[model samples]
Target: MAFGDASFLSRVRGFLIPIGLALLPCAIAPAFGAAALPEEVTVVAKGSGLFNIELETTVYRPEGPGPFPIVVINHGKAPGNPRFQGRYRPAIAARFFLARGYAVVVPMRQGFSKSSGSYIVGGCNVEGNGREQANDVVAALDWATAQPWADKSRILVVGQSHGGWTTLAFGTRGYPGVKGLVDFAGGLRQENCTSWQQGLISGAGNYGAQTTVPSLWFYGDNDSYWPTPTWKSMFEQYVAGGAKARMVAFGSFASDSHTMFGSPAGAPIWQPQVQAFLQEIGLPYEPQPAFAQYAADPAPVASGFAAIDETDRLPDASPAALEGYRVFLSHQNPRAFAFSAKGGWGSGWGRGDTRARALENCTKKAPEGACQLYAVDDEVVWAVKP
Candidate 1:
């Protein structure tokens, strides 16, 4: 599914709802230690043809700067929602970058929030979405670079989901000062999704495989919409095309879903990875130990599955149930695997359980294996394996 597709939104909603439930109460607390709230602003500019354009932005700056490295974080589809934009989106990850002394800008795009202009679903191309959103991002970069507080040379563009594709589009086409690119669940290949194809058609390969900038791509193994095979192929193609690209896939959908980066689950996983990538690319920034702590800590299981008891062996479970359990086990840590019923079963069976179960049963099912009953929520995910 394309990032802009209706199905993508459904997946995003599925991922974000759980995160929102988990983190909404803690929103008031300091999500990151020593991280300060960003200063918000609305900048107005004149677009082509006397169109009044308003760009909503949140800027974070570290103390004492001789032009700090600037990272621009573009928002995903639900830009009008403040909860997702400034409070819950990739901008939150930008905070980690800011805490490390990089200047981070989260733009609301053209049509979302207080930003002016028509809404364009796929804006990578010149004519679609607001062509101005891309240009405005570049303009924001220009404004930042010119600032006495900003560094002109080191600039990074990071996007999540829709923004991920935007990062490739803008960075590959050559944003003036973009030193590096980070795509969190961003689709780089047109073949990866219809939205990417739409973008390719709209932008005319503006950010194609020819990009030479060093980039880091992240995705979730269980992202139902964009399967693992498609994501891996996209990265391989980019690497083959000479783009300095590296990809890391997380075990499950917790940090792999479309909206994962902005979630509480995502903050700890991605913040440090991005920071290290920035540092490696020569971006100026002070390192923070908090991200290290975050990395050291294991993420909590997403709340959707029933707790399983390991004392029991494979029960009268169905072939589908056993396979689901195994797939979940394959993704767990060795220590977690030792826990069997709890760890091996995974956090919970997501909407993809049906498909996952089918794949598992097809791959591993013995005529004699006891079909254990696997309870997921109120329903039996599958009846196999203890």
Candidate 2:
């Protein structure tokens, strides 16, 4: 079956592929180091507009036991009315840090998916709009640092869109363990507001004046939400107000510049800068040999299958799983095949220009006689062996 259509069976919007291999605890390093798989976790954090609320979070770290440096990933807000806010998954970004041996935390703050509370972004007046969300980030960080596996002394905060704005506000607090901040296409816009852009600049300036942490800001030339010029001005105001920061405007990326950290494809465009920033801030930037080797291997099994549902065949497309798929594709012949074994039978999928090429690749990737093609694109090529 084509992997694209198989995605429709997933309950979540992002990849649902399972990650194979057992991850070691933080204290005991694996003999053959492998990146820790991302785990969906829930943390109880005090909410601002609301009282106590549990934020939905994802954690990714190295498979070992010693405390690891932490990187909190703040998710961007979805477009449209504030009444309906969705969850943000940072699996791809988590891999980038996981490879470097850092614990990455992605939290769905209050009012967002799975997190309790109402979505409220102070209307058009736009003054201090992000402070409320910043509180969530701060609360999440507090909980993350208290975890036994996290290194509270070294923390990095990264966010996008509204989350980006939230990170900037967090920087102003000079939180003890925080080392740096990275903003990806931060800020909100309301065209109808009398002077929304100016209000954003003012907000940035206010935060910048008190921001003690070093920061990196990235924006795309084609960002629709925050135009290049407007964001540049915002950065100017931020820096002018005594914020220590560096800003980079990347070339056009994808359909919208705002999606810089939203997809796996966007990783390459921002990974280098992120790596450099980590090193600049004195955090781990290099990947261990064992983990790198693991990343280079092909993936033939689906991960994160539902424990209660035996027939849940949805594939996980998380960064680690997808990376394995990428490795397999890299070794394949022009029309190479990749097979996933499930339920004592083989389910195969491959990319090629024609049916013959696709089937050929599938068979070639499979053992000499073990693989039997069951589906090609939308067509079934073989009946059940039973």
Candidate 3:
């Protein structure tokens, strides 16, 4: 729920420090652990002719030995201006893949961040821009296959926005070891450009013509960048060009559909499609406990109570707790305090079909001890210190 003015509750809340938690002087965690967090790494790739480029990469590895299947995620270009650079972190998507026992590698391509080179794309020629960026994605794939922990025979490329366009471009190359592609709102979109829409269609069709690998493309009906008709036309051209592809168009989401991939709330909407694609392609497709614990089907609401009335931080508030919370919030039938506790405790927020069911759901989430309701909607039912 929209807390609006009362959002300040976040500042006053006390943070729970797990026992043995030690503060680190560094700002971020180091990379590559089964239980440890994803690590930041530098991968040097050979781009074009003999030029070696450095990529800032984040890697999330599942808990295991030997090689794991790899899912390479490509980040999108910022809207309005390509020069408005942002940090690349695909932790949410990485978690999704990690849960499926796949190691996820997200690279900040050349020209972005400290990665070597410049971010040069066709000034107005969107197709040329995509082809250039796809080269970088392929370079990442090349580097991934060479790693000891990555399964060379099974590689998947996925991206959003510009990255999505680049992903389809990578598809056109028919890279041998890479099996599939998933594009979320993929396209190079510049609203003011004279032939922007046609450019995207032409670019997608060109890529589709050469793409041999199967692909899945998704778009929200209310995407701000490329509207429904535009993306639909591009998809038509892509498929008409003989690319084996499937398209799924979802209804409008919380905000602009373009930003869905950036939020945990969007997982329920896209994860299933991805899972089915993996299964169809003969890749491992079991849901991991790590992911299932956080999925909420019907979605949850956080309104009704004062922001202070929320005894524990909601799942959406905590990145560490987002997956479980998203699932917890999406329960089909509503429940009150499906789970809650005072003294800095929280679960997915929901008003269950019945009070008993709410309590049961909460207790089930935390079987370790008694489950209590701190609030139903916005009213405080039980009081506890932060």
lDDT of 1 by residue, 286-365 (tens): 55553332211222342323344432344325464466556654442211211123223323232111222322342234
**Ranked candidates (TM-score, high to low):** 3, 2, 1
Candidate that would win on lDDT: 3
Arranged by lDDT with the best first, the candidates are 3, 2, 1
TM for every model, in the order presented, reads 0.58, 0.67, 0.69
Error of 2 at 25 (Å): 17
- Name the TM-score of candidate 1: 0.58
What is the per-residue lDDT of model 3 for residues 213-265, given as tens digits with 9 covering 90 to 100?
77888899878788788899999998888676788788786547776675545
The regions of model 2 sitting more than 4 angstroms off are 1-36, 47-50, 81-86, 125-127, 293-386
lDDT digits (tens) for residues 1-386 of candidate 2: 11123332231111100001112233311111233244545555564344667666666656678498999888776667443654454545655677667888777877777776776667874546687777777777777777778898888899988889888877877677777889999997778888899988888888888876678898999887987778988999998887667787887875667766754345667888778777766678776554452231121122222321222231333454345334433432211222324312222222111222333344444445444333322223333345
Error of 3 at 258 (Å): 0.6
Worst 10 residues of 3 by lDDT: 13-22
User: Best by TM-score, which number?
Assistant: 3
**Cα-based lDDT for every prediction:** 0.51, 0.61, 0.64
